[model samples]
Target: MSDDPLPFLDGPWRLSMGLRRLEPDDWLRVDDAHDAQMRLRDRLLAERRAEVAAALPGSEAGCAETLALLLEFLPERFPERWTRDGQVMVDRRNGRRVALDGEPPLVIAGRLVQEDLCLMRKGPDGYELSAAVLCFPSHWRLAEKLGRPMAGIHAPVPAFGERLGPTVDRFMAGLDADRPVWRVNWSITETDELFLPGDRAQRAFDPAEPVGSGLFLRLERQTLRRLPQSGDILFTIHTSVRPLGDAIVRPDHAAALAARIREMPERMSRYKGFHLMGMPLLAWLDRLAAAQVRVAAPG
Candidate 1:
């Protein structure tokens, strides 16, 4: 229903990376919620900086390079919303001016855009998370992942080790500096809060309870490019949350989402907390699909 394309509505719900080639200009995104999300990022940086950001000892160069790349990219990508005058870049959305000084360069870069910036550098074992300014983590802590290799960082994700670990490592190691790629992932949550760092305990939902109205569809638009100067991969995640009700207004979308949810593996369902909603969520979606079909039927 929204103007933005809904990937979740076009899904069969399998566990795969689903990566696509990305244009250099589309690395970062801005939307109507930019100002509000930027305000939230500012609050998180001020109040919970340690929790949302971390940099290993040797990561300063990569972090600085990431910042410099963003400084060059932002104004060129969206000149109407971003302007650079000397060391200061002004964000027209919120009228916030960010300078090259003060906070760590990666932190400054995070402040300038909605995407959480992360640097992954190759270590003795493989690529490790070297530095990151992650304010809108879905349910993972930045501190726990810092200085960890790809497998260790993704250990919590179900089937990641068995299914995609080696593939991911190979992809990251082989990623070209000029050829960046991107992927998207979706999650269902009870709230629309952006700064979620801790996992929610599994809760029970009654079969008769209404599960559609209050839920949110959280989307992560993730991009990966190797930083030319640092030789470290720059990973960016731009998170967007929208009401589930608003996303499934069309009959086809509602049916497609319901089918995807039904086809999801049990382990993944539990991992994604879909087990919390149980059958009620599916039933609600089915009803919506039927209602939409009737409304769209010819007279």
Candidate 2:
């Protein structure tokens, strides 16, 4: 649904690689259909409130701090569309509005924004997830991850321990309120579903032309910022899923994705669920490459 054709086509294998700083203006992206997305999020909240939203008894301060930030940041970042004036918060971009009087933090967060909110507090063992309101999970269960430290939550990710674990610890500890940073990750899936939990099978997987019509590119635009009051870091995850076959309008996007998948390590391929889908994807890219060569040939 994002008009961004090549959202994850950032050169080779984008992992937990870049932690570039984010300006206040860039805190959130108000892509198309914000209201509809928020409505979908609210429905998910109503149906799976206990599953998608959670908070610890000791998570009050950090959750409150994060809620405050969203109240002030949403309108500031998207002035034209997101306005919080008087007793009403209006999202003109999506043509949706909500009152400001007595909504719960998770409800307000879920209704007003698209990005899932997670509060991370630093304890003896490092940063642990204190609270979260995640509606669009790629394949992980939010209830199972609550109160766990960063390393525990990421245990399934291959090479995260030896490769990016220490670096992530340092980053979380050193992150400041004045400086927010973000990184991107890419996964090719058999389905286009946005709410695929690890427990459920992907209904979008197609054996025929798996890479052509069945493949979807799922990209997560993740950001981190330290809460001014609680000193806890707030992690935000924004997920986008679009058809790869449709997105490869230009040759370069396909070429970049092909190169990244072609060279990705075996461990990472397994972790990303790419190993099963790799050969078909490569074949699709190969066809595109061969077609381009033919187009470029002289008459």
Candidate 3:
């Protein structure tokens, strides 16, 4: 079990190229919550299949190429639960039952519901989002972001250019397909629901509202790689959600998260939807910290 809880928020926020080389084994995580999470994924895919999954003509080649690579990569990486046969990859565990035929983006996108898939291609306008299957979006819409460049994609984030614009642009430009890079981002969500899209999707973190105080930390393990054959970027977002209460079971999480949340600047708070519940969220974290101390005391 990983010790780090709320990994992106467990430390002081900093502006830097905080990326790492991703190993084969770390590509996907199918945990104890696999069945329940997959049910939700299946439901979303069934209900909004056409809406959630689509791609432009420019992205078709990359999507097919990406699917081929994933089919090869998964079985080779997790031999116990996954296996590849010709152009198809089968989940030996029968977990993510997906047909390998049909649209390349849909087949690849439906590989795992917990993970959202996006493809970017370098056009006259630099890298643009050519295709995406974003089933578990945090608080944004795929329709709004489709075909948009990095700047338009991050328009909601205040002063993003000064903070992360230049750094991310350079990172993507230099990203290598052979050696993929990965990073983590975390946010506190009021609901445990995985597939929250559109403007109403941002989770509130107020203690005043009992419904919003559950505090399931949403973490996205995002990976970036430029496809060797297509020269397109393949970005995968694998989301993991765990109750804050459960996370505090591992030592130091509560105190660290409390400090980190309290120190968030105004621009960040607004973008993360923390302005509505930042104080209440901090208070709740403090209570969790006190409970931890009480449990550890000599009794």
Candidate 4:
């Protein structure tokens, strides 16, 4: 079995909530790619503000509370890189001092961390997407999802309404402020570009290039925490990508991933663009798995 903690690596990939309790200190993650990702976020916020950030009329209080919670949590979680001085928060990694006022609170919060921040508030129907600063959406648009409820926002995802909708709603409804949770979702793509707001039909893999050369494994680590004051769930998505070639180093992992790709439901395969990958990708994975097995066998 692979030593990787990522659930998807284990394989026969299935869609489920799969949420785990999140330690308060581990709320935000910072890594080597922080500088580059932050720069991209800054550019998007400045150039594509309307596309990346939005809030409903009455979501101001929730937005402000979300920002306040982050301001208190970030410095405490990552003291070395993040420090707050009154309304000005300093990021030592890029030497950027962010003023916590004037601009929308969600926008300011998005600039401080790698995760795209989203606020979900309880409405008559259910939890609605009240506000968000979604800089790196995988294949969806922030504009389309804004002001939408849980089920409505995920309407495009196949079987989501029938299979996972009610469970997600119940979980969101009962989520406690002190106890937060996190889960992961993954996808395969041909590009490493993070800003993907277009439809899945736009994805195309070149036939000439080697199957493994440009393939990428994209993972989104999502966290949901109910704010103590506003009772709004602060949803955060931290996206990371790795070269597919680098992910299948171990024989077991390679085999598991291959089985996952092969066994994925038809609709999901098409939804995730695995059908576009076609036989070439599967053949490549089989070869990689066999090679890894040979290399790992007893000398």
Compared with the true structure, the alpha-carbon lDDT of candidate 3 equals: 0.72
Instruction: Please give the range of 10 consecutive residues that has the lowest summed lDDT in model 1.
Output: 1-10
Q: Model 1: which residue pairs collide?
A: none
C-alpha TM-score for every candidate: 0.94, 0.90, 0.86, 0.94
lDDT of 3 by residue, 114-163 (tens): 56788998866568898887778887888888898887788787777777
| Model 4 lDDT tens row, 1-299 | 11227666654677788889998888888877788999999999999999999999888888889888888888888888899878899987668888888898889999899999999988887999999999999989998988899999999888999999999999999999999998887787888889999886644566667766578888888999998888899999988887887765676776777788788789878888887885777777788779877877899
Off by over 4 Å in 3: 1-5, 8-10, 15-17, 85-88, 95-97, 105-109, 200-213, 290-299
lDDT of 4 at 36: 90
Root mean square deviation (Cα) for candidate 1: 2.0
Q: Going through the candidates in order, what is the number of backbone clashes in each?
A: 0, 0, 0, 0
Q: Is candidate 2 or candidate 4 better by TM-score?
A: 4
Residue 54 error, candidate 4, Å: 0.1
